[model samples]
Target: MLKTIMLALAAWFAMAGGGGLAQAKGLAPLAPVAPVAACADLARIDLSGATGAPTRQEAKSVTEAGAKPYCQVSGTIAPAIRFEVRLPLDGWTQRYLQTGCGGLCGNLRIDAGKAEGCAPVTDGSIVLASTDMGHQGMDTAWGNDPQKRRDFAERGVHVTALAAKALIKAFYGRDPRYSYFSGCSDGGREALIEAQRYPQDFDGIAAGAPALNFTIQNSFHHGWLAKVNTGADGKPVLLAADMAPLHKAALAACDGNDGLVDGQITDPRTCRVDPAVTLCKGAYQPGKCLTAAKVEAARLIYQGARTAQGQPLEVGPLQPGSEMNWIGVFVPMNADGPIMSGMFASDTINHLLFTPNPATPYTPQTFPFTLDMVAQEQPARALYNADNPDLSGFAGRGGKLILWHGWGDPHISPINTIAYFDKVGEAMGAPTRDGFVRMFLFPGMGHCSGGDGPSEFPLLQGLMAWVESGEAPAVMVAHRAKPTHEGAPLPADGPMKPPPGATGMPKLPMMPMMPPQPTLPPRSRPVFAYPAVAHYKGTGSIDEAASFEARP
Candidate 1:
């Protein structure tokens, strides 16, 4: 009895003495602890073989909820990779999140883990980390160095994950209970790489609009679009204004296919409007109708790239509602004489794929796109492509994967993701595949975000529920943000931002700036897994997600 009383007194003293035992063990304190170490002190941390030199580390406070304090650490990983990690001062959820970078990944922006209405740092409790995917810039010049190219292809993310986990352990005195990876586009590719190459890295992964078929997607697919749209003078046959009539004709034919003329095409595969219908019967008036050349361009875009024998080249057709955004891919820029996709494809092909030697590099103008060239590039394709169908290792270890794609994506074709999902299903068998993977297709959404359909949804929450609770997601509820004029301007006066990254980037030329439509209320819907479609029940308001049912 005396010994028990003494032990009770000791516990009481520890709690009253400002977390005596907890502080020593690096555990959560009984009371809020002051900043343990200066942000700059993080630079002094030894990562064994990995070198980290801090660029900046500071105590920052966010204005969400109760003004949470955090340490924002920015540094360079060994060689040239840049990384950033955010550690919450209080309310650490014992979870770690690593966000992926997009488009050549030259910047060191960390994505806020926002999905399914939960923000990890602000709304929830999770550590966040991001990296610049080795080297810098939106250009492929980094590909000149073989080591840097390999790092960007795979190593950078793995190193960042390991480094961030070490830092989190040091800060909290305990390793995270779970680790997650979230990204779209190029980041999506990173997510798949983590699953296929480093299956032990993340417990859950959310990949949206992944450019898995890296080589052919940027080279052959973009090349076909450029070649088919270019005139004999090497200029674009179609202009931005020329797209309205085509969009209108397409909407008139297919918008009501889903029992609603709501300006969004629910299923583009069934939409078949003849491009020749847009051809002008009389002399062409600019913007009134398309010429023969323009009509041919539209047909080729909708049909997608093909071999001389009419074999589909796995590139997706441009959806009917995607007309407005084609300027970036189909229209020529005055300065470069090529569209955005053309530029990306040219750099990828000449600099990365077919670099005979750095001193004597090939140019897009001189590169040939024959079947022989495609066959010759197989080795490079194998190196860059993330289309590996094997996910048994990840699934066997109980890792959960959630994939999403916008049906009307103007950049990477939705077909590519669909093809990959199908391939995974085939390799793992339908039952086993369904056990670990789920893919959601947004009807009118474009690229990573935004479209006529409800684009904003919480994928992270769904993933968490699946991973933690073992409750597989059947449908994800999505919301369409208020139109631009209702809330803010189209470009919103900020730098281009990733889904949860700081500062918004410029919208692509083909990305439409949706105007205010007071007539239509803000809409919500349910995006279902593959083999399931959200069907209206004909009872509640069409704008409410509750009005739909996920039916297989």
Candidate 2:
């Protein structure tokens, strides 16, 4: 109790005055406490409280190829919230990091996403924990159970944090100096829900492409994409081959709009792509042109979900530049199997989004895409959606939040993330929001990482700097092995020379031939804070991060 009170006081001072101001307030920094018990003894530690009791299954030493040596403790919170806690054997930094899970999230994943440059993670100086969100599989079958659903919604993370902290204290004899949460995609949803529902759980949070506005996104947005691509005969209107041409066309129209012809639309919102560009003047040619049906399908998808009266049902449509990602997701690769959006929409509607009514399993085709459908989502939204912008509790405690989304995200539209950020500014007041909250939209990046853009950035490192030192990130440098999507490796032996009679231009310059410039494997670029994008300075190589500057 004394220790808890002392830690709370320290946190309060830290929040109130940051570093030097806390000293001016006459408060000394809290000293670290050494381990009071053995690692294995944590198995018997009591974590019972208002939430419930935890059942320990295993507590032992763990050492993997890439990971540092640590004590791996496995346990379950009340009603089967399976969790794992990793305590560093040495170089403990008095910090706790909890990672969120992706998709249905039934398996434990201890990875902190995009942790480059984060000292605690890179140096293996922090305690880490993760959970399966109370279930055992990557499906929505467990949603039928009310307690499990509740656990998956919010309780699981909170309980896991509590258990991890209790175990941390038992082994280290004191609470961590700071706690942080990081996640992307559905895990991003989990991160936001944690901040909204349980503010004190972490001092800093980094949510990437978070699935906020859950009920509408899962039902209306995902469902609309699936249903729109299906023809009257229940066949896919657009195939994988059909999607390439549209993306190619979109690129041709807007790739250079940002003053750089770098195969990526920096801000897709400003780019308007007309589907007619890909429309077949005559009969359809697979990768060159699209038939009217396919063109209409692409147009409708970019137009987004709408009611019969034409009112928009979603935050916004998938941006113009993201059309290529629709191949395996919105459009089908073949004539038959389910697309990605259909699978997710079906799972959500049939099991998780609505109260379990196993008798009536809903699919994209079966679910009604209307305002009534939106109204019916209130119950699930209360538990699932983290759209509430009132993050006063979190901000009040000096918690720092970093919300990032890929501008070219195919699954969840970046517009949704922008909408939420706008709401936060409105709810908390722009000044207050600016103090603790920051949003970064990575151009050409997909859901979490992979896309045409340089999605890899130091998210954890930036969040830590903000939380620990009050240093807000003005811009983040991102990188990719191959700078642009146009990069395709040549033959291993050597660059292929075209036949002498070939009509097309050669890969190398025909006149004034000189050695080709060395291709830099990893290309670095900058992504600025929200509403600001990286603009090329025109004189320097666009591939280099230093050549670009942040502009609103």
Candidate 3:
């Protein structure tokens, strides 16, 4: 009887074109399996009069374990926003993921979905998508086009999500069960924009190190740092070598305050070290001591960006452990001019916010850090900043938001994220806010990832478990990557003896002695939600998360 039923169902599927057939002649209706689209057929999928058109589509077979074949579609949406989507050919998990891009977002990066070890499409289980955020490359010339600027600020990601979902439906014959957005830095800004401007676009969002106050951060703050570091002769007061002593002084003063001498400062807000401590008492020494001007510059950076009236700006001070990373911003390639931050500020101010024209010549010297300058940029701020405190619409619809920031982040201050989280809590009330929103502050982590501390964690899994099973993460474990020595051996003066056990005909030469690897800190730590601290338990291996407890 079972065999006969199977045969009848197969016959019905064949006749019904893989669709359910209504009961007839007293035979019960048979459910049908949805037809899956072939990889190549996805290329022919029409998106005209839709969100975007697919310019290229190809299928590739992945060799990763448990991975299935998938289709990759790349194209441009309205206003020339470039995008790409990857859909699994089999074993669809009924989930869709939209990844965010970083650092001006001129190039497409689909792998942002797997940032910090969160892999949603590991086995072709989830559809993954990414966009170039409207423009291509680091050049902000596209800002001259209002439509492109609008796309770069927010529309690009939203349209990409819509177009991706439409493709998912056309290829799978079903809508996704869930949709998520994940990103860091500018990508994080995009995630917040989705929550604020288009709540319905995603069910869960994981944002890390978001550059929310985009206009102000990239403009005034950048100019302020450059101005403070510039000497009387218009040269950089602080050189790259001066950072080591500053970092050492900071660590020496604050590293043990957390009841552990690990490299991480734990909470830099509590650190009160004076930068003047590194100032030279006598002659100027290159690496061992900082000049008076350089010391003042470092102090200004740590004191945070301030207005002429001495009022604190939106951007926070650099954390104690972020000195090493500051080299990239404070040190110029040559004696003549601006560093990375200065160049970014000059480009943004001249091309994007202030003039929005490439023909207008503007340099770092042209931009001034003043209240008037800040006032002039308000219009662009409104267009770019994602600092909205309200998430009621998102929460009411059962959306989950996971915000994480690296305390050691150098580009955008982590305190900005904390301030934003606090604002959201105040606006929505703690009880209601905690229901759908959580923030994680990773100690010693830098930018999106990588630092002297544990940074890797499966954020996607945490979001899914919270959204699907209502299992909110009380503490997420972040892993510190082990150090590697994969490159060529260090230079040596002459050949050295081989290993004792070696029986080669000729003695093998040994490379120069390499410096001892720095002792790694804790391998993993518990990352708790905002307002809760991860305290040491005082027992067991400090490297393990088991030795930490969450406390308010």
Candidate 4:
């Protein structure tokens, strides 16, 4: 069946090594077997009190960072998980299977003797990462035992997809043919809980800005600041200078709906700004408008959750580059030191909101997380809620997904990932989901990569050139600037300036995805895919990515 889903997605294009071998263009190999037929003779994959080793690295910007190229291997698989296993030994062949989150998401530790400041483009491709799923310690009691929370959710996705296919067959002693997975915000909800509980693993999967109903987004950030962060003098009422004046009033009423104004809005669903447009059509304007308890806390942080008569809840989607912080950003707004930090606030408020343990850590919990505490954490939240739209186990083993999100993502809600990708095209129908799937969004971005459109392309080399060569992905380009960041915006101090490439960001031209409006909108009557931006009725040049039309 299509060469065993391109040898199970060339093992996640060895974890997006070197812009997946230059925006993929290979595919055709498959028949390679014996990846892990039930741990074939188990030689050694131990974990008893797992400690050091697994985080190994060697030489050069983890070798010219086409995007995610870093190298390493050999296991300590357990010496108590320390971290390391980035691949790509040859020219361009990244192999990845990473993991993180021990102190609010971040794993950029890159060492094997320093210097992987990113630059190896043979159209880069070689990736694999692992922080051992649940670690980076201080305390999360090594991922709250329940058999290490079902081995960090379903045997940490088939032991990092069978230990990066046994370290790419101990470095090309054989194996790799295709594979992919990415992250953003618990790594975009662990890339939709690894394509909804391992749909035959990966051929393609990218989930940026995904918080995936993680117990309804970290209990709606501790229940929306325990209800619009206090005060009629109660204190805590929205700080960080009230999120820079509501992100500068949502970029001054959605900056010209996308035709460019710079600050970015692109589309929070038809840029509808009515905080009553920061109101003032009459009196009672206390402290410069927005009151009625600050427009009911900006309408419960923009129409999310509701009940008790005010109805409407279940929400997601505020697209058009959903900006949620850019530089040195680590927002918490409060509930106790950066949202309690880790097994996501000690396994959602001490074992899924019942809160008990370590001899009464601040009691207050009669209880209510509910659907019976999600059926007692459905085998670790169904191995990370690939919220089941059933990809018939990765499309009856033909697999090829590639989902990517951003559209200004402030931690999750790229319209709950295009409404769970229109319920995965209504449970895989339409040409069997056009031979699998595709969902890029990007636009003036945020989490899992920056913003202001054009996001420097690579996507595990376009999902490993569509898992070895059926060549699926059509559009991918991406890039942004402003970098020069190394402590010097201080006239309060001023004078340092050395990082936007020490000197780089300049690769402009490849944008491709937002045509729609200006008459006959909604995806602008046919453009289908690949590095988009159509219209060449002839007379040449729209700056060409090999001359436009990656689609209709």
Each candidate: how many clashes?
12, 0, 0, 87
Q: On a 0 to 1 TM-score scale, where does candidate 3 land against the true structure? A: 0.83
Q: What is the C-alpha lDDT profile of model 4 across 419-522, one tens digit per residue? A: 77677778877557657677676555554544444444566556655656667755454444222222111000001122233111122222112111112111
In candidate 2, stretches whose alpha carbon ends up further than 4 angstroms from where it belongs are 1-34, 356-359, 481-521
The TM-score values for the models, in the order shown, are 0.84, 0.86, 0.83, 0.33
Question: Per-residue lDDT tens digits of candidate 3, residues 345-373?
Answer: 77777777854454566565556556787
- What order do you get sorting by TM-score, best first? 2, 1, 3, 4
List all candidate RMSDs to the true structure: 10.9, 11.3, 13.6, 20.8
What Cα-based lDDT does every candidate model obtain? 0.70, 0.76, 0.72, 0.45
List the candidate 1 regions with Cα displacement exceeding 4 Å.
1-40, 50-67, 113-116, 332-338, 357-366, 482-521
The stretch of ten residues in a row with the least summed lDDT in candidate 3 is 486-495
Q: For model 1, what is the alpha-carbon lDDT of residue 451?
A: 59
Q: Against the true structure, whose TM-score is highest? A: 2
What is the per-residue lDDT of model 1 for residues 1-552, given as tens digits with 9 covering 90 to 100? 223323433453356483221111111222322335555566667764543332323234444556466677666666777777888777677778898877766667776433544545454467888888777655577778887877788888988888888777677776777789998888888999999998988999999888788888777777777767777777777776677788788888998888767777877878888988889999886667989988998888888767777777655766787775464445642323446566766777867775463355544334555677778778777777788989989998999999998886777788888888889989988677877888888987766776567887777777876777665666677888555443322321112433443522223233233323224468888776675767777778788776775554
Q: Candidate 4: list runs displaced more than 4 Å.
A: 1-150, 153-155, 158-160, 163-174, 182-207, 210-226, 229-252, 257-276, 280-291, 299-347, 352-405, 410-441, 444-461, 466-520, 524-552
Task: Please give the lDDT score at residue 323 for candidate 4.
Answer: 26
Query: Which pairs of residues collide in model 3?
Result: none
Question: What lDDT score goes with residue 3 in model 1?
Answer: 34
In candidate 3, which residue ranges exceed 4 Å CA deviation?
Answer: 1-35, 52-67, 113-120, 332-338, 355-362, 482-522
Which candidate do you rate higher for TM-score, 2 or 4?
A: 2
